[model samples]
Target: MSWTDLTATDLVPLPVVLPLLAAGLALVFARRPRVQRVVSVVALAGVLAVGIALLVLTDDRTLVVDVGNWAAPIGIDLVADRLSALMVTVSSFVLLCVLLYSLAQGVSEEAEEETESIPVSIYHPTYLVLAAGVCNAFLAGDLFNLYVGFEILLAASYVLLTLGGTGERIRAGSIYVVVALLSSIVFLIAIALTYAATGTVNLAQLSERLPDVEPGTRLAIQLLLLLAFGIKAAMFPVSAWLPDSYPTAPAPVTAVFAGLLTKVGVYAILRTQTLLFPTDPRIDQGLMWVALLTMLVGILGAVAQDDIKRLLSFTLVSHIGYMLFGIALATQPGTAAAIFYVVHHITVQTALFLVVGLVELRGGSTSLDRLGGLAKLAPGLAILFFIPAMNLAGIPPLSGFLGKVGLVEDGVRTGGFLAYTLVVGSVVTSLLTLYAIVKAWNKAFWQEAPQEIETDARVPRGMVVPTGALVAFGLALTVFAGPLYSYADRAAAALRDGSYVEAVFPDGHDRGVGESNETIPKAGAPAGPASAVDTGEGTP
Candidate 1:
């Protein structure tokens, strides 16, 4: 169908489908680098556009698309509520910027006759696949489909992580792969157990059926899901793999991985926790402690790191605690803040990594001992790095500061010792984050030269422009924080009010759509046909 002819239900799958189709076309045109770049950019641009449309459309209702026109609890469905729509929009925007950044890097490398760490022939297609996977996970309406989404991204990531085939890259990728596989296995078992208990893996159905399952079995299923998603999110003890695995990849790969991947885990956790077990105080309390430890441990590691990449990696882990803290409160205000924080972090973190790439390009290394004098040499780059760094540190008037304030207020309102402790921990983590970022700033930009700078290695405009655009986008978040947070609040309310479940099963039965199978002629009628209606606008 033409773009104008497509309805909201038709739009649900495009975010996932467009990228996969583009990836195939990109692979076919692999021999033509320019064609690959054009295809990748256009595809992601289309996703971004679709995501924006969904974001606006989903503000008032949730949209669901059954893959084969079969109803939920049997056929797969893709969902786009405010939460998933917001995620898809922000992620697609980040993916597009990162693609632009990588394209510029490729051009610069070609000019220098340097051997590329990321080959364009493979990079474009693989990156598109990764994008598709991320969109899939966000949009998936069932547990098994979410698993499929996770696997697609993980498979693509292994290729991107080890693009150079260098010993360091391969070693890091191996560590990453092993951890990912273990998580996947745990997730698979959780799905099996959930199905065994409830007879379906569809999330809306699970929400209805889980409470009726035996309490012990239900709790076990919840914990298994948590363990699996926690590892993927790099929560506390499970987070050890992240800092080691991310910093070894090409800058663009590392940037996307650091920015988007863990957030997917966080998204899954938020969705399941709110939708599947809204009343489970046990897991929520445990999550509070996990949030506290994740914050303190992650920031402590960041404080000790001298490598810019590793330091940021640690900070990435540290800040995840804040999102988890908001989630653990199990309150609408808290969940809203968490959603807002996730958006702020994705933009700010991705921009920081892109700036670090530029720093590495100019300084010849990410290690503090080997880098210095950059502020004097490249003032624009210094500004680019400084903005996102401060934003990440939760400096006042920034979106980060706003998100944290909302979380803290919600925690105090919750009024418990653990909640109070987390409130304190959040403050401490932000301060430490500032300290760590400042130390990197001082060593990399302010300190006297520890080694000769790469004066000949120009920071190409191709790279710098996209990096600047992302930095500008981060600034935009601060300016537009009000409406965004309101949207998040609405999303949180919907999660709590059973609106999503209602949307998925509008008839109060197995059939998600309004029409009935009995309406058709038994012999000649197709078993399932795509639902023509919009599943009705969701109640917020």
Candidate 2:
């Protein structure tokens, strides 16, 4: 933590800055598809390298960068620690995977329609920019910086979602765009309200000032923020926009969306709850109710879908509820469970979606009725789909199972009656999710092929590789869960203390999370003061 030690190689700025610069360069070669691919891919590789460096170099400590030499609370900043770094690592991996898949897709589709292909030039450039946006959001320190990062990603997604411009694509993309834009607008409004009410947008400053706000004011701010983020995270009633929109995109696009977008929303909620309002005797119960509803509702949707992609989309929404449930539990282990679950979900969900796309390619459609006999036709594809599907269903010996165990155990230990009921609901939802996957397998692989169409023989090897990469990568998490969980534990501890503390108080003081109530306030009105938001995943 010396001044000279904080170079560009330092943890704080490199992850976001490298991607931003690379994205700009990629856009320069936007007209040249091949060049754009190289620049973007190389840039994302750099991001992954930087992310690894960030994780290794931190040693469970915080790396704070005060932008332009400004002190905390006044200057914009970035913090790279275990939580942010873990997210950065996962996102970079997912981005690189999707980028490769997209390249393969461009080649495959271009070759197929050589006579009249729809010129997929914009995809490479836009995708790189989108990746940068996601990277920025994950690492941002201040609220407005987070907003900028979100806008960058969302705008890029709007175009990517509708890249094909087909009737179905256009319709789905429009809904996605409208919902996202409105959510962004609401987010902006909330920022304005918070800023006007308390003169700082830096998270740490608000963490200090938020407790002093009137009860009515705090509730208003909290509800607006939750509504905005709930929309983004696709939690419960707000999640309707995800299913119709996601499945309509290209395979790579869908994978990235499934992997990154809602998770970003979940990340946002994690920050807000831990840093801003950890628990309110009143507001938290409301959030818990929403959490339970979101989990049940999403799985129910998943069960009802006939199309493979659509079913996964609903599952995505359902899983978000689980993450929120961890957040709602407001305990160290619960939060840790959430952190583990987020990592597990990103890899499992993306791998599963990619496998579905491959299955569709080989079979011509992902509908339960259209897909059949794939287990015999392509054993490799089956293996790829089977592992991740089991993981997603939370089967044993997988990271998914471990993450759920952590969360459910935490809930029962500290959550009392509400916690136990929700735990039951969570278990049931997991079972339902398993049922949906089993149905898909039975219809697509176990059952015999109904009708024959010889034109598109097997899913190309290119598509297979990217997906296989994800599954193999996901399996690594299971194998290495111990160290990763330790890191996640450290990360959960750091984040709940408020990431931008120096920005809030330039003296650079530390509040020794859960011990200092003088500096960090709890959830209440202007007059009431509670304990610091309990952010560690398992801390009792």
Candidate 3:
């Protein structure tokens, strides 16, 4: 379908618009927490529906919505092709589940009493705004708008991060805010440099113009963008902030941030690597090394953690290396594996955090030293935790295992010392992840309970239900791995084919005045060699 055919595709903007609108309405009803909760849940449910529709619609094509009738390379645009739509759908489902979990947990007595700092009334609205920001970032079609999306989510996150405003949370929030501000400032400077050099910040426009830039200048811009996004994605050397900041937040907040936030940064790297800087051997090699280090360092940290939340946070960083490993290969199977791994990791990681929240709810502490015998006290929670835990460790027949298998296969297929070394590192990381999670399991669920522990702590149905639902979803990804991987492969192909750019600029005007107005190759075309620039035009 053509761009004008978007008349039938108004659903493109609703994922972002609904939550933003609901956030405003929720704020107005903040005093009536019940009303605010209903509004926020309904809005997110609506977004979930829209996400599903967009995913189905864009499965074989692209859908672009130019905001306010503004044209491309100038106006804001929201584009949903296979990749973005899939991300939105998955993330929306995760957000809705976490929101349900939060509401189930209810406001703590301390939060209720600290009305000034906690502002219990604002939680629903701010949470919805956070959802809006995540949706915006995934759907964004240009650099400036993507930055806006980051700021929107980061602002909401700052509020969520310090929800109770206790001393510990405040301190954690302070560190988080400083790091986020630094990243944002760096991101903005990157935007300025990009626009100055290319005369446009629209990604499709950059795809055409960036190649004309001098090699040194292009590499500089590329590294700057990577540095900014790497911090956001919690890559090694920059990931120290995550373990410290995430564990202090309330469970639902931490879960959502853990699952979605870093992935957004990874998504940015995937998009820019393919669209803006498709084939640079040096960049590819650099990413491989970074992936190797992130895997090693992150998993080792997880191994040493006595706290379940912090351990999971470290594991979260470790698995990101798997995705980056695939991207660094810069091949179809590698990209496909990364996309599939992303879907797998988000669900499994978020589900694990939800289970951790449940553990804390029943056992009264996430500290492994204090908890024990949860298997006897809460069999349901034990089962819930066991499934995602094993999945996160890449245990057989689960989605995580499937994702890792794909990555390893791609690495071997790439066939070099670096790829082989990272492959080994990936295996070691997986084994270490298993060891850490099993250690938590033995301490928290299998071992004898301490006398001081509260055996009678209630497991509310609200909390159990969402956590169980997410676990089931993770299993569903495993059960349906064949189709999901196929979808990811197609999405990977589309990214390489530049179908997204064509969808945004259907008139081909953005390809520059003197350039040939050729369309991007179709999805099933033979993929080029790993070293060949997959930029359709083969300019490199």
Using lDDT as the measure, the top candidate is 1
Order of candidates by TM-score, top first? Answer: 1, 3, 2
Off-target runs (Cα >4 Å) in candidate 2 are: 1-4, 8-11, 107-119, 453-456, 498-506, 509-540
Q: Which of candidates 1 and 2 reaches a greater TM-score? A: 1
Minimum summed lDDT over a 10-residue window in model 2 is located at 524-533
Whole-model alpha-carbon lDDT for candidate 3: 0.86
How many residue pairs clash in all the candidates, one count each? Answer: 0, 10, 0
Question: Which RMSD does model 3 reach against the true structure?
Answer: 5.2
Instruction: Flag the better candidate by TM-score, 2 or 3.
Output: 3
In candidate 1, what are the lDDT values of residues 470-520, reduced to their tens digit?
A: 999999999999989998998888887876775566554554334463223
What is candidate 3's lDDT per residue for 282-349, written digit by digit as tens? 99999999999999999999999999999999999999899999999999899999999999989989
Could you tell me which 10 consecutive residues in candidate 1 have the lowest summed lDDT?
518-527
| TM-score for each predicted model, relative to the true structure | 0.94, 0.90, 0.94
